[model samples]
Target chain A: MRHILRETWSGLKRNRAMAFAVMVTMWVSLSLFGVSVLVAEQVDVMKGRWYDKIEISVFLCTKVHGGATDLSANTCEPGQETTPAQRELIQTRLEANPDVQEVLYESKGERFADFQEAYKNSPIKDTFTAEDMQDSFRIKLKDPEQYEGVMNEAVTLPGVQAVQDLHQVLDPLFAALNALVWGARGLAALLIFAAAVQIANTIKLSAFTRRKELGIMRLVGASNSYITLPFVLESLAAAVGAIICSGLTVAALVKFVVIDRAKPFIDTLAWIGWDAAWVAILWIAVTGVALGVIPPLLSTRRYLNV
Target chain B: MITFDDVTAVYPGQPQPALHRVNAEIEKGEFVFLIGSSGSGKSTFMRLIRHEQRPTSGKVYVAGKVLSNLRQWKVPEFRRQIGTVFQDFRLLPGKTVFENVAFAMQVLGKRTSEIKEAVPEVLELVGLTGLEGRRPDEMSGGEQQRVAIARAIINRPKILLADEPTGNLDPATSVGIMRLLDRINRRGATVVMATHDANVVDQMRRRVIELVQGELVRDQQRGVYGAE
Candidate 1:
């Protein structure tokens, strides 16, 4: 066993160039794999934040629907604009529900101010007045997925003009983020495949170089595992070295790049924590070792057939 | 210890068989010489016993086990009981003499104590004592061959094969190597040597098996070279 390890170590040292090539490829692939894990975790954190904060905004009657003078098709209905009685009754019903966590009421003036801030430096800023705007009840649910039941009940309420979910506003963004995560993972898969191939190539070279020794080993009654062990160990060592390197690279990425440098760009995003980083490192390292062992184990089959 | 019953080996991509309808048997404690011209199936015969090549037409039995029916995975265990030496010395180029000899035992999963004991004993037997640190490139042809011999015999295999073991040696060194083989045979191991050296064959006058164009043309007990 000592000889096998020593042989692998010396062979790796002797073929430093080849070993370096294999290590470089492994490092790049595993780091990208790490990056993809981080990206997925970051997206999930952001999704959780957004989902937790999402509310069903039930808008009251606006000027266009409530300001009509006539009592015809264009006229205001008896309860077109929300009255105190209607709002009190609906608020009582919402508060009575088990899934309703909290409900916040926003007056027209407050909504107008928010519109002004949202449309700041734009031509549509002062064109809208508080009187013309609609008031709303932002309904927070115990579970974000339980919004549908609230929306169904709130839509039929008196003076409720529209039922708007914050999830609608954020769905496209999450979709785009998911696409990016899958893209990163796809590229990682290809790079890891290239790494596997490069490992096989380097192992084949090592096997070919040590073939003379292998023949002698075979004739001397060396077991098949003993014959293929050096090559497998060389590959595994290189892979493990690269895995640790890539793990460090990922740690630096999460610590220095994501949480630090990407803060301003990702201001609203919930930064991925160190727990996720460590998980990614552990996952990539284990995967890298397995990936490293498989290729050479296959490639050295014929060489050890002696 | 060995039997080739009408064995014929035909390699792929070659029309003519390497050995056709050949038969021979070698008993234990026998030192037999296989004499043939180049391509006369002498190497094939060695490969047959080594299980490197399966006979195309017949069965080969060694120690009562059939070679052709040998399972692929079990070949190593079978070869473990046999020692093979070649003309090129086949010593690992960069390893020291001690490492070269110890390698034979090491590959077989020998205990460290076993290697530590047996390597020196075999090295001493091959007259490689105190030169254990010398690499193959630093040694002469004879020293290199002796290291190969030491490695081959460290297992004390039941059968020792020498395919022109002294093909590249001086007359004096050849005589010495032959004496070593004779001593090994006298110790009750079967030794089958294939050689083209007329002087060594006639001089030893051991059991001789001759092949001509893949045909077993001669088998004589205590025979000289080419004696009908």
Candidate 2:
């Protein structure tokens, strides 16, 4: 056991440059892997926070006074007003829909107040008043993804001027975030492959340099495992160093980037915490150790041959 | 004891066999000299005995075990019973004489007490007692070869195979190494040495096996270097 340790130390020292290269490669790759995992977790958290609050708005036809023509009108005819009986019929139909979880009547005054608050800093708020706003039914769906069916049926309702699904506004943003997740994951995979190749090269070079000592060991009746243990240990040591580096990098990213910077600015969405970072780090550590140990074990078996 | 029954060894990618249909045997407690010119298969003979190479067609029996049938994992354990020495004196350049000798026993997973006891005794036998602290570069060529011999015999192997053990030594130093090998032979281990030196061969007056172009041309009891 002592001899194996001594051999491993000397082997690592002799190939310190290549060992450092292996560690750097593994560290960078594992860090990228952890970041990708965290990004995926962040996407999931954003989905959970935003999808639960998504609503569908059904705009009722409104009266236009003095024969005014609204060129931007959708389902509403120019100068047409929805009667109270038509409004009640529209609400009754919406409530009967199985996909609708809840229906709340929103008056024009309430919509106008919300519009004013949302565009408080814009000059556009001056041209909009309670009379210009459309009265609507704001709906919560059993599943946000089922908005298409509810939206289609609401457009066909008697007094509905237009049907708007809020989730449409969030689709592009989620698409971009999902793309980033896959991009990071793909890049991490490529870098991990490069790290494995580098590890194999380092082990082969170390074995070549120590061929003489290995030959002597074989002649002295040293077992194959005895000859291979040092190289495996050297690779495992490099992997351990990379695991620590990547774990700390992932933790710092979660703390500084997500928790410290993003969470406060985007307070509406819940961000991933240290637990997610730890989960990512655990994955990176497992991958790092596999990359560190398996390649050297296989390479030494090929190159040493004794 | 070793026996070669019509053994033929052909290295990969080479059309010519290194050893072709050669047969010989040497009993225990015997010191035999393998004398041949370069490429006469002397080194291949030593490699066969040490289980480094298997016979291409025939069988090589060492101490009652057929070497061709030895499994890969058992090769190390099988080799512990047969010590090997090379012409270049394959010692670790940075290690002291004692460490080099002790390394042999260490590879076999011998206990510290056993290694601590046997290393000194083997060094004394090889006449390297006072030079235990000196590294290989600090020693003369003869001393380096003595360290190699000491390492080989430290495990008390049943057979010691030396391939041109004194190839790099001067004539006077070669005699000193031959004397040390003769002392080892007298200690009940079979010794097989391959050499090109005619003086050592003629002076030793031991069993000689001569190979000419991968074929055994002569096997004589109490033979000299040449046919005459």
Candidate 2, which CAPRI tier?
A: medium
* lDDT (10s digit) by residue, model 1, range A106-224: 99999889999999999988787888787888889999877778877876776676778887778899999999999999999999998898888888888888888888888877888
Name the 10 consecutive residues with the lowest summed lDDT in model 1 chain A: A68-77
The recovered share of true contacts, given per candidate in order, is 0.67, 0.65
Clashing residue pairs in candidate 2 are none
Error of 1 at B17 (Å): 1.9
In order of appearance, the predictions have TM-scores of 0.83, 0.83
Measured by TM-score, how close is model 1 to the native structure? 0.83
lDDT of 2 by residue, A1-306 (tens): 888898899988888888898899999999999999999998998888898989988878877532343232255556777778888988888899999999999999999999999999999999987999988899999988888778878877766677777677899999999999999999999999999999988898888888878888888788888888889999999999999999999999999998999999988878999989989998998999899789988887863343
Which segments of candidate 2 are over 4 A away from where they belong?
A13-22, A56-167
Question: Model 1, range B1-228, lDDT digits (tens) per residue?
Answer: 999999988889988788989999899889999999999999999998998878888899997899878888898999988999899999887789998898898888788998999999988887889999999999888888889888889999999999998899988889888888888888778999999898899889999999988999999998888775
Model 1, which residues run further than 4 Å from truth? Answer: A58-63, A66-161, A264-267, B68-71, B111-113, B128-133, B137-140, B170-172
TM-score of chain B of 2: 0.97
